[model samples]
Target: MDIGKQIKTLRLGKALTQTGMAEILGVSKSTMSNYERNISTPDPDTLRKIASYFDVTVDYLFNDMTDSPRDIIKEGTAYHPDKALNKDEWNAISYYRRLSDEQKDFIKGQMIQLYQKSSSSNKG
Candidate 1:
């Protein structure tokens, strides 16, 4: 696993500067640079600190996976690469994501009722 690359990716993903991360970790900028550049490796204590700061586990930091923030999808989100949604559908999704829990439940109930009505109409 490329630990240096993982650290660099996490730091850049958070939009944090090397100097800023260095100060946060109580290390020198050169040390941070070195860590990112694969010139030196941080001890276990520092690894824990970095993991905590990045909201990731130490194993993840040292793991072979190339993690990126953009690659992580939010929960309850739907993604269909084979089918593209229309603008109205996209807008509805955006609006739904911004709605409160109660509003979502209300909308869901309304949708279920609409679907039932449409089904009955078609049956007739």
Candidate 2:
């Protein structure tokens, strides 16, 4: 769904009326209505307020993913060592670059099977 639909869904989920949400965001009810109807978009400051009110990331408001904000990390221009993959993991990732198409597919299928088995076992 688009940003407008996501915003409306979040607002309704919180049981907030347009006036209530507008009050929280320091905007007019008509402005909130326009936002929900996709007639206008929220500016950066307003977007930040909305995201904070919903306890979600700015990206969550804009992006298609529903994953938790904690799981999402924004990278800066300079990479941080703590956030970078370890040497072993990087080597394994690089190895995939050398694989043939058939090999890649086989590896992907095997990984999926393994994940499914692990998940099913966890449920039991």
Candidate 3:
């Protein structure tokens, strides 16, 4: 199960510090430290809250789920077997994730335009 490892993985995946996560959960920093270090287990309520906050099931936290949601989403996305997305692709993805809905649409439009240009060039 390794709940502590899963918690550490998820928290780090989300780029949240222990203090930040503790503040969100209304727990002391030491408590969060304890949970991540496997020194102490969080109560059921806290566990549920953590699961909810991370948008994962409680079973996932307790079970052996090796991949984080971010890893799953970004996996093989860039099409290079040796690695995931390259620096430019990674940068674009990271920035796109923070965009507003309208901005996202605009980016999609730009992508369509690029695709069209490439398609036309290929035909020529």
Candidate 4:
């Protein structure tokens, strides 16, 4: 199944209207509709929000697994032809992709600070 179909199926299963999901994801209703209809793809951040709202993993959203949904969850990680992006990582990648060159430089600076902080914490 396509990502759009999977998203639509999951949304319908959860009894959520497109508008409702759009509101939660801070996107336009039309954008949500586009995603469901496969007219446009969701940026990674939006994909993460959708996965989080539906309590599913990114792999489950992108793959066609015949096994139980619970088993998919228990498996933790699975490869999908689609980008293998978990929620937060997807959001970060999406944000980076949308940045201008100057903005990307700023982001790199910020990441350097964060990485330094993390490394220092590990040493303590």
The Cα local distance difference test for each model comes to 0.81, 0.77, 0.79, 0.75
Location of the lowest summed lDDT over 10 successive residues in candidate 3: 67-76
Using lDDT as the measure, the top candidate is 1
The reply for model 4, stretches above 4 Å from the true place, is 65-124
- Could you tell me the C-alpha RMSD of candidate 4 in Å? 10.5
Extract clashing residue pairs from model 1: none
Count of backbone collisions in candidate 3: 0
lDDT of 2 by residue, 1-23 (tens): 46888799779866899999999
Give me candidate 3's TM-score against the actual structure.
0.55
Task: Give lDDT tens digits, candidate 4, residues 1-124.
Answer: 5788888877776689999988999999999899988899888888888888766678778865423232312234854444444556644654676679999999999999999999999999
Q: Which is superior by TM-score, 2 or 4?
A: 4
Q: After superposition, how far is residue 68 of candidate 4 from its true place, in Å?
A: 8.1
Following a full C-alpha superposition, what root-mean-square deviation does model 1 have from the true structure? 8.9
Between candidates 1 and 2, which one is better according to lDDT? 1
Off by over 4 Å in 1: 67-124
